[model samples]
Target: MVAQRVAVRPEEIRRHNLSRLLRSIHQHGELTRAELTATMGLNRSTIGALVSDLVALGLVTEYVPSGRDRAGRPSHVVAPRADGPYVLAVDLAVERIVTAAVGLGGTVHERRVTTIEGADRLPRAVVDQLAADAEWLAERLPGSQGPVGVGVSIPGTVRRRDGFVDHAPNLNWRAVPFGELLADRMPRRLDVQVGNDADLGAVAEHQRGAAVGCEHLIYLNGSVGVGGGIIADGGQLHGVGGYAGEIGHMTVNPDGPPCHCGSTGCIETYIGEHALLRAAGVTDQHGPQAIAAVFEAAAAGEQRAVDGVHTVAIWLGRSLANLVNCFNPQVIVVGGSLAEVVRLDRVSVETELDRRAMAAARAGVKVLLPGLDQDSALIGAAELAFGTLLASPDSMVASLTTT
Candidate 1:
């Protein structure tokens, strides 16, 4: 076995400490110098030095508390700088594209959403639209440098090594060099990262949404197509080739309807937006809004819509049963177009899970609606971009300054 390499450089050690400090502040929103010293278990002088370095790098700012106790002088609070380095986050959904410029500490500085016309479904068209939207959003940030990184979230499998979208059945894209295409369109040369939307949704939910603090969780997304992400033991489960969370393709009914992935009876065949609308006997020219209307009809006691929701919920619960048995996740969050449907009739889904899943596993799990709503995947993309900078603040700072 090859020996594990260890980092021993003083700069490397300082960078590591800075990363830890940034993560701590980012996770907690803000921290006082005393709080940072206590939480990080570092000496006060070291904590001060780290905070000073972050302040100098323009990553954080030190401010005094608004109200103070009558005891003594209040410690200065360290918070992420509002005008600091930011990342461009894009969510390229089948029906729409949402883009945002997000700052450190999970703050969304600016955002824009554009619906995709049916004619603009090609891979090149999508990439061009995304590049245009990113440019528009970047232009709105006043007195700021360009984004340090860009993260694109797509509804498909992505190769881990280079951000290539291996396949996006919903978008009719196959083995597309999405990162390269988007990078070419960008005005500036910056690292571009791509990830599966569901996987990124899981990361967002685990870090800042409904599944916060959950060591084991499942994030199920419903869009034009269905997808899922799994977090086991506080880590994402990326199987060989980073396609582990393709829960949409799991066989729920071997004899059911066909899927775009060339598989029959997959969970997506029953619960995806198009499938749900078809089952409800509803027809509309628009996409996600049409699905939302169907769920609204179901809530208002429309027979066709109610039946459609019931059928989808039953199938979704059955699929969740399998996932629960496999991962024993602490929570299962349903998001995207299916969120309202799941929220309207949660009992029916739970009853089905109670029947199909193991009693022990079913008892401990909590099924929830998305905390971040439609923004989960976009925020996850931002998290990915922020992660790159936080991991190596010094280098990231240097790159930003030079660029």
Candidate 2:
């Protein structure tokens, strides 16, 4: 018995190798067998066997390279199957719900955006809308294999163990078992996963967006509220309870306004959508459009708008300075409404960084917008939906096929 435990099983090794190959193709779109061998550090024969297995599983296909070298035969290229597996990606934002069918290889096939009018009535309605949206998108795939799972991006704190929305101040959600609720509404067989919007956005940007190869990065998602998704040493910076990247709640001002999270002078109150509006002296108007209007006014040389934007820029810079000192990220990708803020006032943000951050840390960091644009969270949710499938490609494909 002691001797038996010492040796690893051959089948386990095969599974691990197969998953590695699939993940590579998923991330890089396609690769030749030689390239796979080099990138994965596996032998040529093993790479061929793994590619064949994936081909048989309908997860990937092999194609001859269009251009051939006269010196020798061209290596076959492996790419994800067009009609292969896909997942439902739901982005629950401050003003709208965006849904998409994201397939293998990070391809977004189709999408739908629904605007939210009433926040108070969202609890039951939101889940129903998500369920219907998933089904609706799945129906339109047209000869493609069905979704493997459902990934929802909510603007709040989520419980990883059970997809519970612990708190979503913007959506007015609290203690909701969001995963189970959506799963109950959809097909019982489909796996439903929920995560924080900012966290998912970070994952998307890291996987295919602005900071693709960088191991250390910070993605600040500023919508109705400001939240952060930090990647340290090539992984998420999830704290003890999976709530580490709450940048909005960080104390940016000691004598600042109150935040929805029951804190005074939090970063969110200073840089969030409302913060921009108040600075511009806009009243009885709200959400993204109003915020954009303020920036437009500033662009038009309105004094109030200019001052308001300048004030917000000072705080934004200071908040970024705090992040730079602690995390020392390689790149800071700003998305959502804040992306616009950075576009209009990047110099001011950098000015604060110059004044507040250490010279060494600030020098290496680059501030950029989301590479995937406004769809980072939705794409990240799609990545989440594909997690189980990517873990064990062969077995997961089999289950998906039979079901």
Candidate 3:
């Protein structure tokens, strides 16, 4: 005999429907009540109730269209509330930290960037500085209510279970409980989520940047070092333990110069900022401005700069060839300093790809620059914070009420 079905609770159904409606509006920016009804395939009355609940919770706002002449009565548009809850997004790079306050509908309300110097390189010092920065940003928000949460993007591998930095060679951090450290330093109790910068970059690109609508994509980020993130079948590919996208460490030339990770001939050794600078016989520090100067020189026909970029392109192409054969992504986004180099010398990189990559693997694959550029990881961090609220609208409302 078949088992009896358990009765579904009406409250649970209401919560689920509310979440679905909010998610649709969050994803699509703004939708009229009638449009939401048509898109959600729900009855008009149900859509009205759900939107009303969302507005009551301060998650969305309904406004009549302005400056438009319509043939019939105008339907109200539902959009994320401008004065609603927001989250703090921190992007902790090797040499700098960027903090942003992001609200619903992907609006970045406030942002600050600070460069790290000598003693601040210590992990503890970095955490303290970022904590202070976050506190400052939190105070500037419109309301007194605390942020929904904090989402941090680090340039390293992070453990999924406990938010530890498994390895961050560029930052010289290893096996540090970075998430816990930051949480402890927070001015107030808040939920903190940590993720790899490259992984988050891929998330941003797939959702709102260059890779939008592309299910199979790869994102390669080059700063002081190289990092990678993969998206497969419309989801971020986090392998067991969340350490899958370490493409920078992939051995490209076993006999080449040693990498910061103690690996020889890694992809970063060939395409990273230091590698490019050394190849061009430049001794300036490896920063975004320095890298841009190199590219500008190449654009002006400087022989050393041109040669350095070409060498980088060849190695990068070889690395992309491997990724193409492995993942067969529809698009490959080259972000950060590498994007500048590629923008200046696309032909060299494409020629190498044509020669090295398998025809089947290279077919229909487009290599593009990041649409969001340096902001991709930061935007993704904001998305992470927004996702936490969207996942549990009822709990979020309760939390806000108590605050």
Candidate 4:
């Protein structure tokens, strides 16, 4: 006798389709079951069954109308439950530690910032302060759901694969297990993600700021030491070891000055805050004031001041031109505390790039200032936390069919 083949029920396929349909709806926000079915090309019964499962899982809620949908009772709409869970984002900068509680809706519920003068303070003190702030916020959440994850943005090269901080020169840290340390300290069970500050800033820009939809973008972070984040083809290109965007060390001048990285004349030798201060003869004062001093002196037509800005701009422009030739980016965004001082209104740098970069690469590439300024990294860190909860597999599976 020939082997008999078993027939598959239409309901089985419908159930599977229903699950996927609901996930799509949840991803885009509230939608009617009919809209879900139409979008997913599934039958009405499948959507209904899937929605029912979501409702039971407490992952979705129904929006009931008072009356009528074209000669019948109004159809109910479904939306992902807003009260599900939360994530905590910690932005660890050289001078500050900022903590924020974020949700699936990308809303920041609470935030706190603690300042530090130097790296001499205990690392445990910083962690304790951050944890305490998170506790204060957790008390204020509407429901019992705790934070699902924690994301930290550090101002240095972070090896995400092993969750280690290779170096944070600004903060004077080395080989620190930053993520694991925070995870062990927090009261709630949390999955931690550590990333470079500039990289996270680029992510925020891509998601909601200036770099939105651009295929090739470079975010050159002008800070204590210059670093950058690159995005190509709509995704952040974190190289093989997740350290691809370390553009600060790119040599701008081979024999100019010594850099902390033990290199002579790196781009940061000219573009870094220290270089600008020294060029302007205001190395005594630290932080944002030093940058302002350079601008003020330049505005006054002082030779040292004028020379400082011109030299920095020239080096910055040259480095940018080289990057343009290398990456062929659609846009380059300049961000940091100093980005606010000077407007890159006209490109003395673009002239350099025009001379160096390929015609096509130079044609439409825009190098502009970041809209968010220094806050970009903090905001990006919070976004990272917010996305962590929304992008979870459980959240996706729960959105469609609950069972």
Candidate 5:
């Protein structure tokens, strides 16, 4: 023992480098021992020790069969442990709670959905449903390990510092201590995290779907309400109070319909699901089904349908144009149910961006349809959980070990 070099901040550097190494492995998937050493620029001994520790913690596993080019001898590949730790993602939509169990690799293993009544009891009901769903997922995790954390994606502005809901018009929640309530409702052993739904969706798209490798991005959500999420430098821009991506409330038209936020003519006022239905003169059906029917009719070339969708498209374009001017994101991703229609008519949306967005803002900005489609929010929930584990692995481990 040569006194371990008597380093002052060696452990800090080691932890940071370990995190970087883990991120590299996660981003690249399977990597051999030598490949990791070369990519991370860590000495062989250091890399080997860290890899061994990761394996012991079940964060990584060895892959024997090599799926590489010119593989003569079977070299061992280290990869994220798919069966080691799990993440629970919950998408709390306006009318439903979409819950999914995902492994460390960001693959969804199981899913369930519960409807919300949108009344005063909405919060309690949603919490209860989630608790039940968590239990259900816990029962079928398919491994000896437990869920590392619970990540919730909701349709609102989350106060990042305190994990409270600043305002969720659809949920009628105002300044609610969302994270605290949800955590209290949880089994006390699980680590709980909350995020803006649109932000999480952006993470899903950026990490595992269409926006991969695209750093500056704007993700638009078309559901009961319209929302937006922004990603810069491979991370979400949560703003000063975590209310960064509330583009739906952007003033698209001064004389538009009244929004739930007590403002008139917000973007959501003219292009939200309800607004689209009303614009299309649809009243019989409700929720996403009605919106879907409107899109279907538009696809079939119905005049009213075409007009409704076009109007919505124009409003959406204007809202996005504002975002383009503000952030100048490299790509604009349209997601959710309405994104289906937008994908079918990408030319129109792109044309709007070109026409309204500034020259420089529109230069490299490409309008992309939803990558994961309807599964975006679900997968986003999974990504949310993965992020939680990355932040606090020990708390996550404790949470998983309970029950």
Candidate 6:
């Protein structure tokens, strides 16, 4: 028997086209009608109609450049509206939570940050803080009752299917339905999309930051703990249980340090904030500033600080070699606390990686700082918040379905 043929519905086609067009504009920041037509393989009329539809919905704006008038043909440029629909993005690090109202097309409209204290670090307290921040951001949105979506970046393992956080040792959170809890706090039962912070950072970098155009990349994020996100073959490598990229827990030393996860000598134990500080002989200082000061001291050739940085660089390179051998990524982006570590002792780290990594796998890998600086995860959260909107922009006009 022959396979039956069922054509795609016209409405489905329209939704797909609109989704692609909007995403293209979002990715490139701006594009001309002719470029959209060429890139999308759609006719000029179709691109024009889609752009017009998006402009009508206030999701985007199109304008022709004045100087092009001399050429007698000026293609209109399509861009995400600066005042378009927005979403709430939360970056939940171990010590702080950064929240922002991020508009469509990757613009941050308003942001509020709070340091996590002993009591506030608990699940409920975190939820309360996020809920309050959401309310605050909602009040400032443009002509809206709520945001398009909410994206949270957690410094832990998350089961993305249901937004379940399996384990976040740094946050002392375990077996929590964090996504569900945050969703319950929303006014209209808006669903919350939660992801591992490092993973989200990789997404942001792969799309527009350091790893742009690279098919394979790894993002190593250092905070109070280490986390990683891997993009393999242009897609995130999420294993069977969403714990695939937990490289921080990978044991690099069998008898070095005790990790919060009850593991000995995990990579995070060596390169994370606390580890770096302890190595630098700093006792009373904390936060990113203290970490930066350690690097400054190392650069200034302070004996203890220099020794600490060199030690950390060795471990960083060894761990990176392991990843390069396994994934053969084209780019490895060092972010958060580790960014300074890489910047300070790049030569030592490169030497270690060259010694350990297989020649073939090591050939094309480029280790670099995050292109978006400190905002990779935050911007990535914005991308997660926009997922629903990009998938079916029509949902913006209709009431967005709640999960």
Best model per lDDT? 2
- Give the residue spans of candidate 1 off by over 4 A: 1-9, 68-70, 283-286
TM-score of each: 0.95, 0.95, 0.95, 0.78, 0.90, 0.95
Q: Among all windows of ten consecutive residues in candidate 5, which has the lowest summed lDDT? A: 391-400
Give the candidate order by descending lDDT.
Answer: 2, 6, 1, 3, 5, 4
Candidate 4 regions exceeding 4 Å error are 1-84, 120-122, 142-144, 292-307, 341-346, 386-388, 393-403
Per-residue lDDT of 1-403 in model 5, one digit per residue for the tens? 5666656598767666666666666656678888888878889899888777677677889877745775577656888877777778888888777888877666677889876664633677777888899899888875747676788888888875556888888888888887888889876666677888888889888987789899999889978888888998888898777888888888866887889988988888877888788777887878877877888898898988787787777777777788899999988888876586575565666678778999987897888887777667677767666765665444445455555
lDDT of each: 0.87, 0.89, 0.86, 0.72, 0.78, 0.88
Global lDDT of model 1: 0.87
| Candidate 6 Cα errors over 4 Å, as ranges | 68-70, 142-146, 400-403
Error of 4 at 257 (Å): 2.4
lDDT string for model 1 (1-403, tens) is: 9999986998777789999999988877799999999998999999999999999998899998878554588889999998887899999898888889988888888988888866687878888787787778767987765688888899999985688988899888888988888888875657788889999999999888999999999999987788899999999999988998998998877998889999999889888887888888886644777887888899999999999888888878888898899989899999987787688778888999999999999999999988888888998998887777888887888877776
Give the Å shift of residue 49 in candidate 6.
1.0
Flag clash pairs in model 2.
none
Pairs in clash, predicted candidate 4: none
Query: Which stretches of candidate 5 lie above 4 Å from their native place?
Result: 1-10, 66-69, 391-403
- Model 4 agreement with the true structure over 1-403: per-residue lDDT tens digits: 9989998798666455545654465345578777787887767886787778766655577887655445676668887666656678887776677888765434566787777766433466767777797888788885835676678888888988645888877777787887777778875446677889889888777665687778789888877877888999888889988888888888867987998777788888888888877776775687766677667768788888777776667667777888888998999888874463336313556566677777888897998777566667766776665453344434544443432
Off by over 4 Å in 3: 1-6
- Model 4: lDDT to the true structure: 0.72
Residues forming the 10-long window of minimal summed lDDT in candidate 1: 283-292
